[model samples]
Target: MNIYLVYWNSLNKFCFRGILDESIGEGTHFLIPWVQKPYIFDIKTRPHTFSSISGTKDLQMVNLTLRVLSRPDTAKLPVIVQNLGLEYDEKVLPSIGNEVLKSVVAQFNADQLLTERPQVSALVKETLVRRARDFNILLDDVAITHLSLCWKFVTGGNCQRCLEDAVTRIGSSCRKKEDGRALNSGCYLRHSPHKFYNNSSSNDVAAGNRGHRKMAIILAASSAVLALLLVTATMGFFIRKNVMRKRRERKQFGTLLDTVNKSKLNVPYEILEKATNYFNDDNKLGQGGSGSVYKGVMPDGNTVAVKRLSFNSTQWVDHFFNEVNLISGVHHKNDERRKNTYTSESLRQRFNRDSGMHS
Candidate 1:
């Protein structure tokens, strides 16, 4: 094996040769064994620097400093040796660095890079790594160490136009205000005041007119403030009313839920099942146009009616819960009387049917 010394200049061109006793040409060269040998490259780190001026979105010039680490990509050595000759650094590395830097920097403005240095650095590193992949090189990192603006053309006289523009704007605003006041007061410019302003009476009339206009402005402002206060009060009233309404609704719903939970109608599913004998036909009391009604007896010997709706009873399905809720809310004081009347009527009909059968 032979030891080689390698050095790549700023242009990315490589200069390398085997150990030889004397200096050789600029390109890569070979050497014989031990009889004549050259010293190998002993340096641990190398630096590559390039300078360029970039343009911002607002057409400002910025000077940039770009420094890159120099190293050989051993994975692509074979291809580099075949196509680019032994001086691969001269042909590949500089080109990659320059293109990646130009492309990435051109996408950002000067202010962005200056304010967001870390982000800009990361962007440069990513771009370089992607471009280096084709040559089998991995970029370790990239950094933007220095940035500055080139302000060689600024002068004091350049601000004269900006000052004149500001004065013109102020004059235009004052003229517009004066013209509006004249129009509001219905003043016809029959005579030019440029000459008549020398008279004392004319000056007094102008001063009085200005005082009247000032008083009108004060009155208008006071009216606007009063109207604003009234609107605010009305809005607050409506908001409070809506809040109170919602609170009442919630309170009522909570009370109704508590009453239902505590009522005797809070029958368990298992008890309902035992009372109805698993919904047997023998337990069914009557069949109506809507559905069959079953008679169920509770564990405490209390009788209750259970109405099971039929599948096709769409009208019953819609009104069943509403009817049950209405019936549940009837005054408990009259409930016993109503129940007695219903039972007596049912018994009378049954007795009449039996008598007719016997006859």
Candidate 2:
């Protein structure tokens, strides 16, 4: 027989015949020789402190001190041992903590982390807990005990003096307040029940107030200039659009007038009167129900039949329609070489040429 020691405070089991798994308890136990091997695990709560170097959202490098309280998940002891072996803490905790710290730090700026430590620490704890669960580690708590820039920012002599004054003011003004931090461009002073920062005096708080006021003034001026520029641009755009629209309309109208003029014959009233010999009865050709026709000699020494419509007649609209259709289709041809009768198209072409010369 063989004797084995097992503890109930942790998960203890025995492997029998290399194939059978059985859970055991605390105290001394007897087992057949070469029949079983006892496996004991330590599952105790403990704290781990570590420092990590990472960059914040603002690209400022920061040094962070983190303390984590953790333990092994007793229920998952068999799985942890089987999957990651007994040295899982040594292999996993450091890496998990480093990754979680970096991820959390990247979510906030260095200034924000310093001023709002509680908010930042709470977020880090929540994320670390969830991440630890994946590795079968129980997370009790996570605390960001310290946060600072990795590089020492140089401060001006005046700013340093002001920081000292601000720190003294904060100490006296709100003694009951649990936490306070005096911040400046180059450095900060944080105070609590327990000392957390260097024992250096800080800059003046009035400098910070002046800086905020100047920034506000600049922002207001910039907003006014931007608004003026936007309004000017909007006005210019509409003015240009209206001008271009009017130009397009005028151009279209001119084009339409040119086309209609090219398709029509516009004989001047004076020229018609002269061609018909001032409407002498001798030039009258015939009379129609709507109007009268006369034989006329054009300036080019050609004879044409001009039908003058009577606008006062009640049938003037019907007669005008008939005359338009007749002029569009009427054609005259001369069979002999000396004959030179022109078609209505030729008349319109002649009229355009004559009008162009007069204009």
Candidate 3:
């Protein structure tokens, strides 16, 4: 089952009798179980951050964070495994990166380091790229994400650089590994009357901080205003929709009342409820496909026929309103009973014919 394992986007190291042989490309390559073994290497490009503390030429300690985009060089996979094994980048990048950074940074002064950042980055990347070729690791990109002065930096008088150099020399005496490179007094400023650090630099940094704070505040205010506008628009949309729906309902009620006024058939629901005993089945005289007809006693003790429409059909609403409109202008030939059990079919037919509809 392991022999038929599927793999993609990976490099496989094919070995015979547990000996490092050759690297293979992506695909299923079955092994001979005990005789053959394959080591898989994920050849995906990923970023590695390298942190190193190195002094600038002006003797101010600068901390550097190097972001290196790397992947295993496919052609050199066997050599990579033999040399540094699976954790090749971890073994090689930090050593080379620190060496390259310290060597490159020692050539530039602290003032030039801040002012000429692009040239500094290019030089570091070029040096790292050249050094990485021998390690079988391909560098896609190299960048200095952070370049900052140490927080422990202090400034005093005209002899500040010299004092700083002597103090660093004293501090490096306790460390054995970095003892050789620690006292890097590649000092740019010598016995000069100028201060190594000044008040104006602090003011500039404070101004930059203020500008960033203002930008963040403006961004937050803009986001809040935009959110408020969005909520207002949403609320206005729903409110206007509700108002329009209510207006439409009012218009429909007004129109129904105007049409019923023409036929003089504006009987209130309570009066009809009382007259028909709340639509009791006993009061129902006849039933048809459209509705039921009920006999009712009016307020003047006169007999009346009330038709109740069947609301089960979706077309009932349209049919009910249309019938009222038809009856509104209709004139019967008989001119007889005002309240009858049946509608005037002949008059209704004439109204439908005049109105250009059969029923």
Candidate 4:
């Protein structure tokens, strides 16, 4: 009689008669003796900590750390064991994590990555969870724990020796792309070298394979001048565009203020922020197709709706601007009509009072 005790946190799959094809869960009295093989898996959640070095959109190297809480789905164990063996997470998680890291980090510049860390983490987690699900893995939590610029090494002289050394030292960290190539992907995440050396093409021949003594200085100066020119052009364009946008908004706002003077709803935006607790999640009322609306309590015991539109959404800017125009025009017209009605009522009352006094 062959029998084994199975614990609650563990799952067991057995094979009978040297064949695992659609037959499983052996090592029982019902199975023939010496014909069953057993495999056990622990279904416990575990923390996976990994560090990835990737290049940012601004061409800076970033070292990021991610901690993931994950476990295998017990139902998919058979397929996972067959395809990936027992060490499945080892073969899958790191590769996919590194890939997602590179793809997401490349989209954001270093400053944006730092300023908008939450959004970055959310993006990484959303993509990583989907990838893990494809492998029958369930992720409970994913977060970016630490981040810093990869300042391990600075600028280096352009030479084949430096290139070969970089390839040899941290080469193992590089991952193979989906195309099945073992190229030097690691160098992309590391310090930026003065030159890139590949087998297909050599470094500049006219530069005479020398160190960056003269060539480096001249190149650095030229790059600085070019960067300055580009920055000046970009700043000028943005400043002009911003001025135009503000001018239009102010023009619309002026019309509203002229009609709605001394209106109760004329509260400052800062006051709205205070009333809604700075757009706290708890104050959220409901989300519409266009944006989210929140419940706000004014200092004067007035309840107001605070609408916040998502600027990053694919929605057209014209739609938002048009909505603003409609709101302003409606309020201005209403105020003007009310003022005319009040004037006519006051004149009628004065005419009746004077006639009675004369009598």
The residue pairs found clashing in candidate 4 are: 14-25, 14-26
* TM-score computed on alpha carbons, candidate 4: 0.39
Per-model tally of clashing residue pairs: 6, 7, 0, 2
Identify the candidate with maximal lDDT.
3
Off by over 4 Å in 1: 1-45, 152-359
Candidate 4 lDDT by residue in tens digits, 145-244: 9999753343555345456755665455443432222333234334333434454434455345455667888899999999999999999999999898
Candidate 1 lDDT over residue span 137-186, tens digit each: 54555666678875434245544544455456545554645332111111
RMSD of each: 25.4, 17.1, 20.9, 36.0
Instruction: Give the Å error, residue 198, model 2.
Output: 27
Model 4 regions lying over 4 Å from their true place: 8-32, 150-359
Candidate 3 per-residue C-alpha lDDT over 259-296 given as tens digits, one digit per residue, 9 for 90 to 100 = 54566544555566678897789999998656677877
Candidate 3: C-alpha RMSD to true structure equals 20.9
Which pairs clash in model 3? Answer: none
Model 4 worst lDDT run, 10 consecutive residues: 336-345
TM-score of each: 0.31, 0.41, 0.41, 0.39
Q: Any runs in candidate 3 off by more than 4 Å, and if so which?
A: 6-20, 150-359
